[model samples]
Target: MGGFVRANEPEKVISLFEELKEKLGGGMIYDGTPYGNLMKAYFMKGMEEEAMVCYSEVLGEGSKVRFGAVSYNSVLDALGRHEKLDDAIKLFDRMIKEHDPPRRIAVNLGSFNVMVDAYCIAGRFNDAIKVFGEMGERKCTPDTLSYNNLIDQLGKNQLVGQAEELYKEMGERGINPDEYTYILLAEACFGVDRVDDAVGYFKKMVDLGLRPNANAYNKVIGGLVDVGRLDEAQGFFDQMPEKEVKPNVASYELLLKAYVEAGRLDDAIKTAEGILLDESVAFSDEMKELLEGALRKVGREEDIAKMYEDVEREKAERAARAAEEKARAEALAREEEERKKAEAAAKEAAAARASQAAIEAVLGRRKEAAKEESPDGGSNADDGGILKRLGITNGPVEEKRAENGNVVGASVGDESVKQDGEAKEGAGSGGAADQATAL
Candidate 1:
């Protein structure tokens, strides 16, 4: 149960508590600490309604298990999560008025920090300052965490002077600024176009034992770049190693963009290429697209025209290859067609020879039948022999009789034989029809 609550697993902790209550009777885990932990988890998970229910349940259990500053602070944090600053402030007011012994909710640094950030985000910097004053009035001296939050809020409101004042005050109070504080302050200076001021703050940040992180360098470089101070920005980039800091995407992008704006196209292209290929620097898709667009924008007209020429050359090569392939395919088709025609001619010649052989065989059989005929009815026997040789097995004699000396029983009544005769004549004539027929 404790692990679940600490891990921000609110639903699991709530179930465990409910189970324990059911098993050991109603008030088993109604203590302030358990309820407070449950409330914290619920708040962390943004389960405001559940946290409220637990708050009321614990409050109902007994005054002995009263809602302390932690409970009220969790509710306040939950309200901040929901972005209900007005409601959050109202709850804070209620806590201040209620809670016997007037327990201050300032015990939780996170709660105060969140409220300060909410005020800043909501553009209520005045209210944030008031909260800081209250923290002081309550004898709760602000730590570096508290000082960072207030400085960040003031800076976000474009109060660079006030932000600087607060920094000096932190120093006086011996509350040193952290890396985030310097970054935020540098950002504030950059936001208001205070590049020189930003540089000064950055140097101070490094002197305070806070290593200038990537964002800090980016802020300074970007500020210098924005003011067209390319030389100074380059100097900062070169000196990053001395401060134990490293350049990131923003640093490179700012320098590259400065070069582009200054018409130093070659340098811009080189730097962009460097950043684009770096594995550690994960160039955002949008940034990569922008870099490509920037190159096109900065490239000379002659360079662009050369690019088109290269594309045209490639297209010509592809077209030539395709034409070659097509020509090869057509030649192959013609060769295959010629081979098929040759094979068909050989087959037809073999069939014609077989037919002539069959005709000779039939004539030989007819001659043998004539020699064996009975001499007393020689005419009738001759008709039978002729009919047998001609394959006229089922027809009246009149119908089977030849017309104009044509072999009626031998022909199948189709014009194929006449067409074959014409085709053979055409082949021998050397005309267009002859050429087609030969092929």
Candidate 2:
């Protein structure tokens, strides 16, 4: 059955299992190894439901099959791989609780490690931590794999501090970290912006006789570049060839991007030339575009006409984006202008209304004053009072009556006529007195 499973013949394996079950009728017993093999076959064939059924049949109450730790671990691994993390945890718990003491299938460190890895893959970090804690309770000291799994997940999730603590604990517990451990620690340190710590760990990995690979070098260089340590990154990148760890396309691309972003166009051109010169590294279109952009930045041209189309396309995209931004800005400006205009017009309208109200209020007060002055339809006293209130006074008046009893002349303040009449009267009286005395 295992051979069949290895040969990718799941149907034949299943048929064989069915035939074996039928031959070993009612009271017969079988161990879990065959069932595990069958489950593995089902899992390999993408028949997850059938695989789970096989696992259940092994642990079923009526079944005489006794599953050992290896079989249980296999099923647990399948469950984890299938993203059935909750089921895997349940199975792990069952193994610990149900299979202990009687020792039908004792959970081992591999079981815990599998569960931890599953939880990490599912991003269930808390659950993974719980499993890690359970290892200590079970007196199962965690190995390097356990630490690496946890650290890698935590680092990827950007939980660098926790990853660092775990790495420290590994050293304290005398678990010699492998190259993978060092790589994870360096990555975690880099994730948290601890560039110096990352570099130290990377170097420490080399000192421990774990050959630093291209991946390790790339990580350190990338970290340095991320922190704007372009010079340091370039220096490290230059050392890759000496270490016999040839620079990969990613390494060159990182250096190129850093140089371009830092305005070191000359350095970027050199890196681009290195990329082009290396026959091992495939010149992908992305790399070509990056190189072309760097060349343009330094006001240089390349004979690679294939890259010209990409450059022109990028330019068109940039122009379109710029135009969209300009249009959006213009719209915003127009809105702001309209808002200001509306506010000003509203203010002007309010001012006009206020001015009209003030004028009406003044006119109303004058009307009230006029009504108070003239209670009747017409009153001379009231009119005179109004004139006096206005600082106008009536002067003296002279009147003349004609024969028809109609007043023809009415003059005010005729001082010259009054003076002449007074003088004539005085002379006439004097003449009468003198004539009477002579008589």
Candidate 3:
């Protein structure tokens, strides 16, 4: 339903709403969103009478959706947009007067804002102020945004004096002014030819730390130029630099066009030079043509052309320098990355070498252990005791034979007897093997 209304399909919304109402036995939801959409749709299709029925007469029959602040505010906005001031007033009055639950909602900040805008558009500045004043009574106090809106609309309508009152009132109320508030007041003062006040607002905005944008600066500068105060306008423009605010093409053109109109070709040329030097803003083609037209009036067309070419050449050189500097930085970064990688690789190789050395030491010790395990005492003098038990000796060969487990006890009588006598002689040295040999 909201989509239908937003899509401007007023007829679909109305028809579907009716169908849903009848099918659901005249029960329509009214949480303000759909109702608001429906009302806006009616306003779009010029069905204000039907909208009024939904707003006041019908009361949604069996629908449990109560009309709260949102619903009331929505309708009020719709009325304001459609230029139904009388209807908006009635609704606002009812919001303020009605105090019962579900039916009478407390007027919120938005409720008064709608009325303020409505009155502002209707050119009733006094009524607008009155409504702004009444907000505190209703407990929906107007904040900075509310004051700004009122000031803007009043400014647009040429009510600068009334706007000034609001501005002072904002300060008194402790509602801190934003950059936009100052800009609006400045422009409004300009519209009313209060040039001094306009300049003061611009400067005060800067002094108060509410930095004005390029548009705000340009507006004040342009207003000054319009009143034949070229030097003052130029002064404001000069202040932009010290303030660190970048001016756009319009900012330059305001003063440049003024100089050209007054036949100050040299000043125009100087401004053109400043425009080119401004690194923050681009020098557009229109600005070039304006300067060219101004110089051509003095028959210095070729000079202006050559000056523009020089500016372009300077810009190109600056760009090239920037690119070169970027490339140098990137090269340095890559070199640092490569150095780190090389260091890491060196450390890895050193660790691998240390591990290899440790493995070789372990294997060398194991080789010595392998020799020790051989029963023949293979190159290890530590195995001499076991050798004696095996009875293998150039000196004690019988003892060595008996230690080797040669079981010839009874089969080889003479040899055994001989070996046994030798074993007995070596018994003190051979230990257990000599006893076995004797047996």
Instruction: Give the winner by lDDT.
Output: 3
Q: Which residue pairs in candidate 2 have backbone atoms (N, alpha carbon, C) closer than 3 angstroms, thus clashing?
A: none
Candidate 1: deviation at residue 134, Å?
A: 2.7
Give me the runs in candidate 1 sitting further than 4 Å from their true place: 1-71, 81-111, 118-123, 207-209, 261-263, 276-279, 282-289, 296-439
Which candidate order results from sorting by lDDT in descending order?
Answer: 3, 2, 1
- TM-score of every model versus the real structure: 0.52, 0.55, 0.63
Off by over 4 Å in 2: 1-54, 64-66, 81-83, 97-105, 121-124, 136-139, 207-209, 261-263, 296-298, 302-439
Alpha-carbon lDDT of model 3: 0.78
Candidate 2's displacement at residue 377, Å, is 99
Stretches of candidate 3 above 4 Å error? 1-29, 34-65, 99-106, 269-286, 320-439
lDDT by residue for model 1 (1-439), tens? 6688557687887788778778877764544555655666777677778877765665543546545666556556655655667867876666656633333343445556667776777778878877876766545677988887788778777888878888888878887678877787888888898778788878877777777777778878888888888888888887886877767888888887788778776666556655644446765676555555666775554653444465467667878999999999999999999999999999999999999799768856775666577574333335444755587543333223333333333223335644754555555555656678889
- Shift of residue 42 alpha carbon in model 2, Å: 7.3
Winner on TM-score (1 vs 2) = 2
Tell me the whole-model lDDT of each prediction, alpha carbons only.
0.69, 0.76, 0.78
Clashes of each: 0, 0, 7
lDDT by residue for model 3 over 250-286, one digit each (tens)? Answer: 8988988899888887888888887887876676788
lDDT of 2 by residue, 1-439 (tens): 8789778898898889788878888334476667766776788778888887766776766877776778778778767867788888788878888656444546888888888888888988888888887888876899998899888888899888878888888889899899899889888888777888899998888877787888888888889988899889888888888778898889999998888778876677667667765768876788677767766756677534534454466667878999999999999999999999999999999999998798657645654676666646432323333444444344333454445444333232345655765666677679889999999
